[model samples]
Target: MNVQRGSTTFLKVIIFLIGFAVLAVCIVLLPEAARRDAIERPGDYSLYPLLVCAYGICITFSVALYRVFKLLTYIEKKNAFSELSLQSLEVIKKCTFTVIFFIFLAIVYLRVHAQYTGDDAAGPISLGLMGILATSIIAAIVDVLQKPIKNVLNS
Candidate 1:
């Protein structure tokens, strides 16, 4: 029990750090990058809308992270197969899907904008594609885990 408690605490700390790092990037790095892009390419207001969408995705991701933290708490309490844990996994899966959808939109926007401006869209598009892939995998894993958890809860 002590070992499980320690491991859960460690996992919780890791998740907290991840959340902090993501928040820092969204708060500090993204705006700076957007400002630089705006200055470098004057009169191109496309980035602002992209930034807004990205921020919205980040907010959803933050909520998902909070749900994950709650799920961890449940696990620490030896309630990993509880309905609340299942719910948290469901919410996390949905959030990952949302993130994936937003990344797809970002990819489309980047492709269109690149065609119009002749800018190299490869970097951003690749990044968005990777995000989609990663989130999709996360969602799939959560879904797979959910079934087993549901079964356990029922039994």
Candidate 2:
């Protein structure tokens, strides 16, 4: 039990750091990216809205991470099979889908912009594709976990 507790604590700390890192990146890098894009391609404000969307998605990601941390805390307290844990998982899965939706929007925006400007958008488009793939997987895993959690609750 002690070892399990320690591991969960470690995982919680890591999740906290990840949330922090996401905030830090949005704070420090996103504005710079927006500015750089504006300067490099004058009159092209398309990327600005995409950056905003990315920040919104980051907010969803943070919420999901917070839910994961809360779930971990419940697990540490041996309440993993409780209704609260199931709720957290449900929220996390919703957040994942939200992020995936935003990524899809970003991809569509980038594709249209690239077609208009005749620029190479493959790199950013590929990144968005990867995000969609990853979040879809996360959602699937969360759904799978939910089934077992439901069984546990019923038992």
Candidate 3:
């Protein structure tokens, strides 16, 4: 039990680091890159919508990450089978689906913009596809995790 608690503590630290890394990317890297792109292509009005979608995806991802952290805390408290943990799992699943929706919108926006502008949308489209794939996997995992919790709660 001591070892398990120690492992959860370590996992929490890792999760915090992951969240911090994402925050830095959202705050520092994304805006800078977007500004540079806008300066280089001043007429690309489609950029704003794609950026909005990207931010939406990031926000949903942050919510899911926080929920995962909460779920971990529940586990550490030996309340992983409780309603709170189940709620956290459901929130994570919902967040993942929200991200997927944003990714899809971004992909469609990029594709349509590229069609009008004759720009190659391959890179962003590929990234969006991968994002969708990842979110789908996360949702599946959450579904599987929820089943056991639901079973425990119902019993």
Candidate 4:
């Protein structure tokens, strides 16, 4: 039990740091990059839609991260097998699904833009595809984890 608690504490700290880092990247790095680009080209805002999509993904990602952290807290509190943990897993799965939806929307938008602009949108499109794939996997894993919890709750 002591070892398990130690591991949970370590995971909690890592999760906290990951959340902080993502928040910093969204707030500081992304805006600074946009500012730099604006300085270079004052009126070109083609990337703004992608930035909005990124923000959408970030919001969902933050929610999923919080849910994971909450699950870890439940584990530490000796409530890992409770309904709250199951709910956390369900929320995490939904968050991943939301992220996949946003990525798919971005990919569709990129394809449409590329049709007219003749620009090389393959890079971002591929990234969006990868993002969708990753999120789908996360959702699937959450679903797998949910089965036993549902069984436990039912029986």
Q: Please give, for residues 1-155, the per-residue lDDT of candidate 4 as tens digits.
A: 59999999899899899999889989998898889889998998866887888889888899999999999999889887789999999999989988998899889889988998898889989988888888888899999999998998899
Please name the candidate that would achieve the greatest lDDT relative to the true structure. 2
The C-alpha stretches of model 2 lying farther than 4 A from their native spots are none
Q: How does each model score on TM-score?
A: 0.92, 0.93, 0.93, 0.93
Per-residue CA lDDT of candidate 3, range 1-155, in tens? 59879998899899899889889878998899799988998986656887788788778888888988898899998899999999999999999889999999988988988898899999989988998998899899999999999999999
Candidate 1 TM-score, true structure as reference = 0.92
lDDT, candidate 2, 1-155, per-residue tens: 58999999899989989988999989999989988998899997777769878898999999999999999999988899999999999999999989998999898888999899899999999999998999999999999989988998899
Q: Per model, state how many residue pairs clash.
A: 0, 0, 0, 0
lDDT of 2: 0.92
Q: How well does candidate 3 match the true structure in TM-score terms?
A: 0.93
What is candidate 1's lDDT per residue for 1-155, written digit by digit as tens?
Answer: 59989988998999899899889989899999898998899997889768876887988899998999999899988799889999999999989988888888888888999899899999989888888888988998999999999899889
lDDT, candidate 4, at 105: 83
Q: Report each candidate's C-alpha RMSD, comma-separated, in the order given.
A: 1.6, 1.4, 1.5, 1.4
Question: Model 3 residue 132 lDDT?
Answer: 93
Give the higher-TM-score candidate: 2 or 4: 2
State the lDDT at 154 in candidate 4: 90
88, model 4: CA deviation in Å? Answer: 0.7
Worst 10-residue lDDT window for candidate 2 reads 44-53
lDDT of 1 at 134: 88
Runs off by more than 4 Å, candidate 4: none
